[model samples]
Target: MSTVEVILQSCLSKPAGNSLLVEQYVSDTASGRRYLLGRNEHAAEIMQMIEVDGIIDDFATNGTTWNNKPVLTTEQLPDQSMVVNCAMCIAPVSAARRLQKHGAIEILSLAELCSHLPQRFKLPWFVSQTRDEIRNHLSAWNSLSTALVDKQSQQTLNDLLHFRLSGDYHYMSGYSVRPEEQYFEPFIEPSAAHVFVDGGGYDGDTTEQFCHRYPGYRQVYLFEPTPTNLANARRRLKHQRNITFIAQGLSDQQGSLPFDTEAGSASAVDPQSSQQIQVTTLDQAVSEPISFIKMDLEGWELQALQGARIHIQDDRPSLAIAVYHQAADFRRIFDYVTGLYPDYQVYLRHYTEGWSETIMYFIPANIKQN
Candidate 1:
């Protein structure tokens, strides 16, 4: 296809109707980059792509820290009240809420930021489905979006898609989801004790939440590949006996591949890294029955589902797969899962501030019969 066909000029962010949103952006941008909140390497890329004029004020260093810019730690953060939230993937929700309690205005989102910049997210990746794979992927999204059962589910899916295709957070207005709620979505009654597969089990946070939410689980399979992370998860759930720590990553195949970003919980299978790690398909690795599966495997949700096809087809376990890791995943994983088990009730829930933790739940129609 030609470049003109690939480019989505029609869907680009317009600046005419969004004057109210970027009133602060015009004034504040002149002084300097007041506060760029993105902390990871992604934030670094944003900084590099578009020059950040001022300090990168972020104390919470979970992943790889910034190098080029002057990073102000905790003490200096008090002085810098964030006038503009420059596309922080996960907004500082708690702090924003706290400030709101004391009568501060709500923070801006990527959509609000889009009013100032030339772009919101990546260009026309959605409409550029000229290739067979992309065409199929787009078809899956359209199919699932239409056949989504509930109106709310469909809207949520669209809203998340809107944010992904264009970095707009309008759909996220007046919504807050607790972490416990992320795994245990409403509308479906979860059995008190059930077999659980916790994919991308980072530092036992979800495991701890799962224990509280569904106490006395029959069994739990916690999958984490990085050595340091596995050790951390082990240490966190050391006292628990029902927990089974699988020291490998999940994918469509069972073999070794180079894992990326081995720094704590952010590690995932990436081509850039040469560090080799063992990865196995769920069908080949898991022997017992699975009642529920929650995958947040970076961007490998679809591939993992393919590996676990046999299990899903047989057991029809409730799924809480992360779809916000990439745009197509929203449809690809959901389509495949529901296609495997047609009677499942689907629900969309956004766990984080933006499109990061948008989890798609698929519960079997006869879940109570389990």
Candidate 2:
């Protein structure tokens, strides 16, 4: 039976809707057997019963079972209720507590978790709602027993959003772009304080897109380190009087380092990849006010953010950062950025509608004033 089913069965013998006392029996690599004693009122309720305040222990002293009997000794349970010793049954509960401790598992906040959410989620509000829903539904699955399933579902959601936003799908136009994202009327306009910073100006695809839709952008700054990409960006934007191209990669440190170019998207200034290149610091770039920044610099996001401390603090511009390159991208980047700028209203969005692209949006709390 499923872990939830067994837990519910164990609690249903007496009460059907209150918390019940539940203990666990677990084995360790060093200790032959061990017991995890605790009280979980919430889990008990989820298991369909209320746990009375009582001591529950797992005393499986014997090393093995006998006559098809469990080796662990335990206090007598309520009459008509069988002892629950299934490792699979209690595994999920154990994991749930651990994930909660690490601050990695939780249902979305009530306001964030709206009702009647669209199942076939798309961009803008739909994207935010879908992720919040997944986190809420799978909060219990973040533990070891169901971690694999939880991770797989997370990946699938990431991919679905990526594919929808990559701007390659034929159906992209049919989804009804957000008013802020529309090419005109409501699209982001350029201002004297506005300077577009492209962290990974790969052949200036972003530049071309920006210029095509919002060419009046006050000043365009492209950061491309690859010889091929740098040359292309230079050729493409050379005629634009407001555009400036930099042949450097931003990193945590302000020094040159090797970058793995072979992995392509996996390229890094560290040993994580095969190709290598010298890196620069964002501090070395423009000192003027920047209105918007788009980062697609592989997995060097943390280090890049560090180097841009001055820019972020001084400019306080809008950010569209790619977070798919690293495993803990969501937690690390989101917490770090938002923690530093508490007043900024951070919005998560995936522009790539594919398997592993997750782009996040960061705007000052007063972004709507613009």
Give each model a TM-score: 0.76, 0.50
lDDT of 1: 0.65
> After superposing candidate 1, which stretches have Cα over 4 Å from the reference?
1-13, 16-53, 56-84, 92-139, 367-370
| Per-residue accuracy of model 2 over 197-239 as CA lDDT, tens digit each | 8888877767777776665667888888887878877787776
Model 2, global lDDT:
0.48
Error of 2 at 260 (Å): 1.9
Q: Considering every candidate listed, which one attains the maximal TM-score?
A: 1
Clashing pairs in 1: none
lDDT of 1 by residue, 163-217 (tens): 4444544445545645667767666556624888999998888988888777767
Quote the lDDT for 363 in model 2.
67
Residue 190 miss distance in model 2 (angstroms): 4.9
The reply for model 2, stretches above 4 Å from the true place, is 1-193, 263-266, 270-276, 367-370
